[model samples]
Target chain A: MIRQFGLPEALAILSGVQATILLSLIAFVGGGVVGLAVALMRTSERTWLQRCAGFYIDFFQGTPLLMQLFLVFYGLPVLGYKVNPWIAVAIGFTLHASAFLGEIWRGSIQAVPRGQTEAAYALGLSYASRMRNVVLPQAMRISVAPTVGFMVQLIKGTSLAAIIGFVELSRAAQIIASATYKPLLAYGCAAIVYFVLCFPLSRLSMRLEKRFAVKT
Target chain B: MTYQFDFSVLLPYWEQLLRGCWLTILLSAISISAGLTIGILTALAKRSRFTTARIAAGTYVEIIRNTPFLVQVFFIFFGLPALGISFQPWSAAILALSLNCGAFSAEVIRGGIDAIARGQYEAGTALGLKPLQIFRHIVLKPALRIIFPALSGQFVLTLLTTSIVSSISAEELTSIAQSIDTLTFRSFEIYIVATILYLTMSFGFATLFKLIDRVYFSYPVK
Candidate 1:
């Protein structure tokens, strides 16, 4: 039975906006925590730590997200862990986000002037205090714009979870389109919802970038 | 965990995997060339004197940038058929990729164009150059030099994006990996191999771009 592409169908697709947002949030927060450690490691004095962090970033950034998701989804089972699409996608996106965010923050950390670190050292501040009090605050300010910019990317990326049958916005659109045979309406509606969710963030990112550019 | 690993099962399908990589490279090549053309045109339109052309170009870029590429693919492949415009999976994949890349590269190209000072154009005109000659001699080369690094980076990104076209069942490496997974049930092994192949391709292209930048964009030191 072919259902009509009515308000009900549109709402069904729109319903998926929640899952998409939730997934993005989970990935962003989870990635942020791990990403901070990665960023610090990349900027550390230890050559081995820097090399390990560099490889981690390159491995994630160099491959397709689809393959990464597939690896976790399938690889987990081989290791004798039960897997579901949600768990797999969450893990995949978190790792991907960490690599990207880690790289961004590393750049920001380095962008802090050498004079600041020198002054902290001259004041007899320890390495931990120097980083926490002097370096990271400035780096955080530099990173805000790009971090918001990345949120836009992360939101759109969540759509890939639909491919693995996670029932997100894109998957919901697929379900409706296939059922109602109104691919145009189903996908178009989903696209609009995504735009609404993403456009403001894009604009805010650009605005923040401009503001920071002027200040710097 | 007593799971035994077997990668030898995929050895028999090496030819299929190779073929898939060839198709991916083909798709990316065609789309990048086509997209660059579209990008140049759109960038010009965005800078045009006419209000309509500027708005149209701006609107296209904004809409494409804001939405996901997968939905765009679905809309083109499946949705267009409703309007009596249908494409084969491969054609649809190329069209979507080109359109997506065009929007992104337009912004990058436009930034390059804007970086060129107005005095350069006036200088060309003072030298008795025609407008077309002015653009060719004074504008294009330097603009390309300025944008080549970002443009090549974007191209690498487009190459990776070709994998997403697999969702529409277009013939590519990722799609082939899925097929082999069902056949051998060695999902982990096959994906590992595919990921490594992708890593190699990206790194290779990045190195190649650096070489091209050195060859083409570096200015002669006096």
Candidate 2:
């Protein structure tokens, strides 16, 4: 028997939004930390470090995130690293986001004019201080729009966590669809919830792009 | 770190893995061709004079762009069946992938079109060109040329996304890898091979895209 999906059912599925949002938050923050380090390495003067970082970025960027998640979830145990689904997804999404964000941040850092860096050097600013004080601030300004834009992609990327058996929004939608056998209602509700979540960020990204475009 | 890696178990399934790679590439190709056609049409509808056409196209793009492809796949597969319009897993996956990527590529194409200046068309009109010829020569070609890099990036991404189709049990690389993992019980080694296959495909496709760019899109300056 096909059950009718009511407000209660929709609400139950919508409840998965928290898990989705939480997963995105963890991935973004975790990815941001790793991305900064990798971006710095990619932009560093050391050839070996640069090549290693480049390889890391290319490896992550080229492969499917689904595979990456699978590898981390299933493959790690072979190497004797214990991994639950949650930890697996955390590592996977963080790694995936870092690769993309590292590329973005590297471009942003390199975008800062050479004159400014040269001026900092002339002023006796050390490498660390130059980046922390003079360079990163400028790069952060250039990066805000792209970074926020990437946040939208990161949120969408979290949906893949469902494949690893995390009960995030996408997975919860499937569960609801199968449970009720009213997939039209269940998946319809899922799409609506995702739209509500992502549309605003997309618009904000466009607006930020426009604003930044004007400034530069 | 003393774990012994048993990659030898994977050698037996080499044919399956190769076939899976071919299937993955085929899926990406089919989706991208259909998706790009849809994108061009959607981009046109979006810029069309009719308000209804514009809004309808706008809504479709926004809805698809904002939602996750996995949810979109579920909706098209399981949800459509509830309404008595079911598709097999492969067809459903291709439909979802094309629609999802179409929305994105529409934006890319639209951006390219909009970047062209009004004066260029005016200049074409003054040169006694028909509207169609002007659009072909002065607008579409250059717009496509400019968006080639963005299009290439999207191509790589669409190729990666084909792996997501494995969730719906499509007979792609990831699904094959999963089957082999269970049979061989050498999950890490199998996945490592699978990852390398994907990396090779990605690089291979990117080089092909670049070649296509140079051959078809590049124009010599006078």
> Candidate 1 chain B, which ten residues in sequence have the lowest lDDT sum?
B213-222
Candidate 2 per-residue C-alpha lDDT over A75-132 given as tens digits, one digit per residue, 9 for 90 to 100: 6786788877778788888988888899999999999999999999999999999999
Reference-based lDDT, each prediction: 0.93, 0.89
Worst 10 residues of 1 chain A by lDDT: A81-90
The local lDDT score (0 to 100) that residue B59 gets in candidate 2 is 98
What digit string (tens of lDDT, one per residue) describes model 1 on residues A1-216? 999999999999999999999999999998999899999999999999999999999998888888888899889889998977788889999999999999999999999999999999999999999999999999999999999989998999999999888998999999999999999999999999999999999999989999999998
Interface RMSD for each of the candidates: 0.8, 1.2
Q: Quote the lDDT for A122 in model 2.
A: 100
> After superposition, which runs of candidate 1 have C-alpha atoms over 4 Å from their true positions?
none
Top lDDT model:
1
The model with the greatest DockQ is: 1
Docking class of 2: high
How much does candidate 1 score in TM-score? Answer: 0.98
For candidate 2, the per-residue lDDT at B189 reads: 86
